[model samples]
Each structure stands twice: as structure tokens, then as C-alpha cells.
Target: MTKPVRKAVFPVAGLGTRFLPATKTMAKEMLPVVDKPLIQYAVEEAAAAGIEYFIFVTGRGKHVLVEHFDHAFELEQLLGARGKTEALETLRAAIPAPGTVISTRQQNPLGLGHAVWCARAFIGEDEPFAVILPDDLILSDTPAIGQLIEAHAKVGGNVVATEDVPREHTNRYGILKVQSDDGRLARADGLVEKPKPEDAPSTLSIIGRYVLDATVMDRLGSIGKGSGGEIQLTDGMAATIDDGVPFHGLRFEGTRFDCGDKVGFLKANMAFALDRPDMRDDVAAFLKDMAAGL
Candidate 1:
């Protein structure tokens, strides 16, 4: 029987330099998308995909993130006194059950590869796992991680969620070199992180979600730094691909927002605000006033 991919790792150690000043004191993962923080969306996604245990590879100044997943007595009591049943439901929905969530520190700002390596102890030996980057806020009916997990069930190898990016924008992501094109599922021969446009293998960029084999932990071990003098996760995955281990990309149906980028973060906020009934009106009016000035 294929080992079930029941655990997920979230690499949230970044210093959110992009959203600095605001992020200097706070973790970007704690920033709210609607009512829930970015990390909450990712955890919920893993849970929806049938993942049982969640591992958060966190860093300094990320205490609020861990707290967000825990119970809040003051707020619960306030809601209880006010008879706010509906409001309480929303709060409960955002938080995962205690003990199901866990955290480990990624002491060094090494890179994504090192962050995953930090979770190795929690991951243990020879079971498949998933990784989600909070920066990639996937907008879809189903969580993007769920799509990758479903694909992993059929193939029993590494699976990465992919989406078409403008050919001109390939440098912004980890690009996949395809061995065969099967549309929604591509036979990935290799992957390169943030390649120059001329060097990029294909326009299908790897997003945040990945159903990774625990073997990847070995590949990540003491791996040499790539382009940015940072250990890239693509390097490890690329090693697996070259060894003839099957790897596939799932072209999930969704809008992806690179919440790590300033413009992308603003767009996500606007898009989410527009989706909320109460905020839609005020947010629209605010945008209109701001646009008229522009």
C-alpha cells in the first residue's frame, strides 16, 4: 500500500522583507486575508486535503501565528455573553483543533530547502508529506493543496501544483522542464528555480503546494546553494527527477496571488474585499475614490 501523505509542512520563517516596517514587528503569515491569517488558509487547505498533522517551520516574531491556532478564552466568552453564535462559528472555522497543529523553529534564514529540513524530525522516516508556502495564496473553490494531494493518490510520486504564467513572467517562479505534456498533468523531467526568461524550460510555474516524498529530506541535507546563495527546494526536487523517479505537475484551476509581492498582496486584499458582502460596498467606494485621484 502506498503511504498516505497525512502530514504537511509550512515554511513560514521568512522575514517578510517585502512588507517590511509592518512586517519588521509582525510575521506576514499573521496578516489577514479576510478574517483569517495567511497561515490559517494554508492549514485549512492541508486539513481539507485529508492531511492529519500540521508542521509549521516558523521563526522569530512568529509567536502570534502559533497563538492564532490556539483557543481564545476572552473572545469565546465575549461571544458567549453576546449570544453571537454565527460569529463564534466563523472563529472556530478559522482555527485548527489544538494538538493537531505543531511548530518547530527554523533558526537560520537559510532557504526553503533548509526550512523543510527543519521539519524532518516531525516528518520521521519514509512517508509522503506536503509543503505549503504562505506566500502563495491560491484562490479557488478547493484548496490548491487538495488538488496536489488528489494527484499524489493516483501517481504515488512527487506532485507539485502548477499554473500557467505569462512566458515573460517565468523568471518569477520555479519553472518546470516537461518531458511530456498531458495538459492538467505534465510529466516533469526537471525544474529550475527563478531562471532567466531565455533559460526557463516552460511557462508552467511551480506554486506553493507540493506532495513530497520524505526522501526529499536526504536531498535537502547539506545541499549547495543555487542562484541566490540560498538553498532552493527546486534543487532537491530536481535531483529526484533526474534519478528517474516519477514527478508530475497538477495544473490546478485557480487564481494564484503571490502575496509575497507588494502588488500581488494588494490585489489579493482587493479581490477578497470585493468578495465580502459588507466590505464589498465600502471597499469599492474606497477604490473608486482612490482611482479618481490616480
Candidate 2:
């Protein structure tokens, strides 16, 4: 039997240069989507998928991300005293069990592959692990990672969440060279990092959620700089493909918001806020007025 995916790695070390002043003092993952931070949403998603170990690959100035997962005694006490039961419960539930959530620093601002490599010691020689980029916020009835985990159980190999992109947008993503497609699962023969639209094999692009085998760590170790002179995750994954490991792209069930982009971030805030019972009416009205004014 294949080992269950017990651990998840969150690479939250990226500098949100696009958000500028807002991210100057805080980590990009600390930015709010609605009421919860992006990193919090990612952690909650992982937990919902039955992930036991949450390993955060952090960088300088990401202490706020670390503190968010910890209990706030004074705040909790204050909320309890004020008879705010729901708020208190929410706060308490945010914290993982002791030692369940741990952080390791990446030191340098390398690419996503290098960030995952930083967490190798934590993963050790254990079962397959997950890597989630908080910037790619997926809203679905079933968490995106849960979908990939389910596929991993069936496929028994590396599983990456994929979604179809316009052919013109191929250069913006790691394009998939699909060997077989059954709609939900695509057997991948190769992966191209940001290929030109004309050169793209298929428009099915790799998203942020990944359930990868432990051997990928070894592949990443041997992968030199790729694409943008960084250790691209696509390159490492392709190496596994060449070694005869079964790799697949799972057409995940969700709506993904690229929170790293300015427009996408704004859209996520609006969409999530509008989903809230308390804020829906107000946000809708505000949007109507703002649009009319324009």
C-alpha cells in the first residue's frame, strides 16, 4: 500500500513586491483575503484534507506568519470576558496542536523548488508530502489539495492540480504535455516552463497544489537552474517523469485566484467578502455605486 500523505509544506517565503508598502513589514502570505489571512486559508485547507504535519518554509520578516498560528492568551482572555464565544472559538481553532505546526527558514529568495528543498529535513524519508502556494487561493466545496490527495491515492504517483488556460496565456504558466486525457486526469509525458503559445503542447497548466512523491526531493537535488535561472519545480517534476515515474495532472474542482497579482487579489477580496452573509449586501451595493460613478 502507498503511504498516506501525512505532511504538507507551505512555501510562504516570497516577497510580495507587487503589494509594496502593505507587504513592506509583513509577509505576503499574511495579507488578508477577507477576514482571514492567505496563509491561514492555506493551513485550514491542508487541515481539512487530513494533513497532520504543517511545515512552513519561511523567510526573513515572516515572523508574523509564525505568530499567526500561535495562541494569543491576552486576546483570547479578552474575547472570553466579553462573551464573544464565536470569536473566541475561531481564534482557538486556528492553532494547530503543539508541535504539529513548525517553521524553517529558506534564507535566500530562491524559487519555489528551492523553498520545498528547505523542508526536506522535515519530510525526511517519510511518505509523500504536499506543497501549497498560498498565493493561489482555491475556493471549492472540496479543498483543492483534498482533490489532489484523492487523485494521489488512486494514481499512486505524483499529482499536480491543473486547469485549462487560454492558449495565449501559455507563456504565463508551466504548460503540460499531456499523453492521455480523461478530462479529470491527464497523464503527463512532459512539462514546459512558460512556453510560448505557439510552442505549447497543451493549455492545461500546472497550478500551485501538488502531492508529490519523496523521490522528487532527489530529483530537485540534481536539477540545476532552469527557465529563469532558478530551480523551477517544473524542471524537477519533469526529471521524475524521465525516470519512469508516473506523473499526472488532475483537473481540480475549484476556482483559483492568483492572489499574487494585483487584480486577482482585489477580485478575491471582493468575491470572498460578497460570500459572507454580513458583508454581501454592503459589498454589492458599494460595487454598484462604484461602477455607476465610473
Candidate 3:
């Protein structure tokens, strides 16, 4: 039987240099999309997908991310005193059950693979785990990770979320060498990290959501620095495919926002804000007026 993906690891150790001035004093994962932090959206997605354990691979100055999940005794008391029952309920609903959320230090800015490897001790052999890069926020009727988990149940191998990218943009993503395309699921024979458009095999670019077998940790164990001299998770994933393990690409149903980029962050703010019941009308009208001026 395939092991259920019970735990999800969040790679939140990045320095967020792009959003420097704001991130210089805070973790980027704490940056808000609409209202909730990026990390909160990732956690809620995992929890909704039946993920029981949340492992956050953090670094120095990431205490704020940890505190976000913890109880605010004074704040809760103040809300109670003010008869803000709805506010208190919202806060309580956002937090996971005690003992389910834990943080571990990554201590270095190695790369995505290294950050994931940092949490290997929390994942045991014979168990499958999920990794959510909080920077890639997805809005879908079914949470993106949940979509991958559902696909994992059918295929029973390492499953990654994939989406088509423009030929000119293939260099920005890890492209897949697909063996066959079966509608939503593509059987991949190989994965190449950021190949030039001319050298690319297909446009099925890998995204941030992944449901990986624990054996991926074993492959990552020996993966040296790749591409930009950082331990890339794509390198580790490719090793598993090379070893003859079944690899699948799930064309997940969602609108993904690359929140790590400035343009993408602004896009997410506008998109999510426009989706909110209270803000949609005003935001839409403002956007229309702004477009008219442009």
C-alpha cells in the first residue's frame, strides 16, 4: 500500500532579497497576500488536504513565522473583552492543533533541496511527504496540494504539479521530458532544470507543489550543488527518475501566483483583493479607473 502523505514541509528559509527593505527586518513568508501571510495560505492548503503534521524548515530571523501560528494570549483576551467573538473565532480557526506544527532550522541558504533535506529527520522511511514552496501561491477550488495528493493516490509514485510555460520562458522553470501525456497526468521520463528554449524537451514546467516519496531524501543526500551552485530539489527529483522510479506530472487546476517576484506579488494582491466579497466592487472600480488613466 502506498503511504499517505501525512506531513508537509515548508521551505521558508530564503532571505527574500528581492523585497529587501521590507524583508530586511522580517521573513518574506510573513508578507501578506490580501490579509493573511503567504505561509498561512500554504499551511491552510496542507491542512485541508488531510496533512496531519506541518514541518517548517526555517532559518535565523524566522521567529515571526513561528509566532504567527502560536496563540496570542493578550490579543485573544482583548478581543474577548471587546466582545469580538467573530475575530477570536477566526484567529483560533487559523491555528493548527497544538503539537502538530513544528519548526526546524535550515541554518544555510543552500537551496530548495537543502532546505527539504534539513527536515529529513522529521520524515521517516516508508512515508511519503509533501513540500509546499510558499512563494508559489495557487488559488483553486481544490487546493493545489490536495490535487497532487489525489493524483498520488491513483499513480502511486512521485507526483509533481506541472503547468505549461511559453517557449521563451522555458529557461525560467525545470522542464520535463514527457514520455506520454494522458490528459491531466503526464508520465515523465526525465526532468531538466531550466534548459534553454532550444534544448528544452517540452513546456510542462515543474511548479512548487510536490508529493514525494521519502526515498527522495536519499537521492538528495548525494546531490551536489547544481546550476547556480545551490542544492536544487529538481536535481534530487531527477535522480529518482534516473533510478527508474515512476515519475508523474500533474497538470493541476489552479491559478498560480509566483509571489516571490515583485510583479507576481502585486498581481496576487490585486487578484485576491478582487475576489474578496467586501473589496471586489471598490477594487474593481479602482482598477478600471486606473486602466482608463493608463
Candidate 4:
């Protein structure tokens, strides 16, 4: 039986050195894409795909993040008394349903694999689960996680969100060796992490969304650290490929913003702000003036 995908893990333990000063006092996951924090967007995507349990793998100083999900009763009461009805509704929408969200600490800054390992008890056994990297914000007609969930139901091994990158850029991602390409989906023969440009098999690179089988956890458990000093999830994923457990790279319909990168982060802010009805006119006018002056 294909175990229903009910749980998701968000590894938000990284010390966002990329956005140093801003991240110094706050978790990068708390950074806003527009009005919503990066982590909120990830949870919303998973919730849209029918995820029943949300697990966050976090480090220290993330208390505010947990509070973000809790009931803001006092604040809500104040808003109600002040007659800020529409504003109050917006705040309520961001709060997840009671008892659905949970978090655990990842003691050391091991790596993505270690962060996931910390959630093993929550995942238990006999079920598939999802992992969403909050850094990959995909703007799409369909939610990005939903795309992976749809493919997971059909293909049944591991479904990952993938998009073609320039061949030269493949060196920065987990490049896939294609077994077959049915256009929308590419069945991968293997996953090669950060391969040199000439050695890369295909440009289909892994993105942030993953729907992984429970068996893969066993594989991840036995794997040793590779490439870097920390345990690598890519190494575990590559093992699944060797075990002949199927894996597919799905070219989802969307524009993906690599919000982990500074430039991509700026673009996401601009794109989302410009798309909002309330902010569009002023934002666009400001952009036009800046462009004309430049």
C-alpha cells in the first residue's frame, strides 16, 4: 500500500550566513517574501497539498517562529476592539489549525540530513513524507508541493520538483541522469550532486520539494558524510537511485525563486509586491522612477 503522505519536515536550522546582518538576530526562515515569512509560505504549500502534520527542524533563537503559529489571542482581541476587521482576518489566516504544527530541535548544525534525522521519531515508520526547503519559493498557478504530490501518487518512488538549468549551472545542483523524459516528468537513472560541468548528465536539477518513501529513511540512516564534513542528504538520495527505487524530476509549471541567494531574494520581494493589488501602483511607480533615473 502507498502510505498516505501526512507529514512534512522543514529544516530551518541553517545559520543564514548569506544574509548575515539581517539573519544575525532572526532566522532566515522568518524573512518575508512580501507579507508572509518564508517559512509560512512553505507550510501553506504543504497544507494545500493535504499535509496533516507539519514538523520543523530548528536551531536556537527560533522561538519567534513557533510563536508565529500559535494563537495571537491578545492581539486578535485588540484588533477586534479597534474595529480592524479585515486586518484581523488576515492575521488569523496565517495561523495554522490547533495542534497540527510541531517542532523539534536539531542540536548541532550538522547538515540537511542531520536535521531530517532529528525528525525520525515524528515520521516513525510505514509512511511517505515531504521535505520542503523554504528557500525555494515557486510562483505558480498550482502550488509547487501539490505538483509533487500529484506526481507522487502516480510514480510512487520519490517525486521531486525539478527544472532545467543551464548545463553550466548544473554543477551547483543535484543533477539527474535521465532514463526517460516524458516532457513533464523525467525518470532519473541517478542523482549526481554538484558534478562538474563536463561530467553532468542532464540539466534537470533538483529543487526544494521532495516526497520520499519511508524506506529511504533507512538508507539515509546508514549513509556516511560525503563531499562536506556534514552528513549529506544528497548521498542518501543517490543510494535510493542505486537501489532501483524510482525517482522522477518533475518540470513543474512555475517560476522558481532561489530565495537563499541575495539577488533571488530581492527579486522575490519585488515580484510579490508588484503583484499585490494594494502595493502594485506605488511599487511600480517607484520602480519606473528608479529605472528612468538610472
Tens digit of per-residue lDDT, candidate 3, span 1-294: 687899999999999999989999989999999999999999999999999999999999998998999899999999999999999999999999999998999987998999999999999987899999999999888999999999898887799999999999999999999999987899998888999999999999999999998889998989899988888898898898888778999999989999999999999999999889999999999999999999
lDDT of 2: 0.92
Off by over 4 Å in 4: none
Q: Which ranges of candidate 2 are over 4 A from the true structure? A: none
Which digits, one per residue and each the tens of the lDDT, describe model 2 over residues 4-77? Answer: 89899999888899999988888899889988999999999999999999999998888889899999999999
Query: In model 3, what is the error at residue 80, expressed in angstroms?
Result: 1.0
| Residue-level lDDT for 89 in candidate 2 | 98
- Pick out the ten consecutive residues of candidate 1 with the lowest summed lDDT: 89-98
Error of 3 at 172 (Å): 1.3
Maximum-TM-score candidate: 3
TM-score attained by model 3: 0.98
Q: lDDT (CA) for every model shown?
A: 0.86, 0.92, 0.93, 0.87
Tens-digit lDDT track for model 4 on 1-294?
466788999998888899999999999999999889999989888888899899999888987778888888999999999999999998888788888888999989877877887888888676889999999998877888888888888888888899889988987888889999999999987888888989999888998888887767887788877666777777777788888888888999888999999999999999889878999999999999999998
Residue 292 C-alpha lDDT in model 4: 100
The most accurate candidate by lDDT is 3
> What is the total number of backbone clashes in candidate 4?
0
| lDDT ranking, high to low | 3, 2, 4, 1
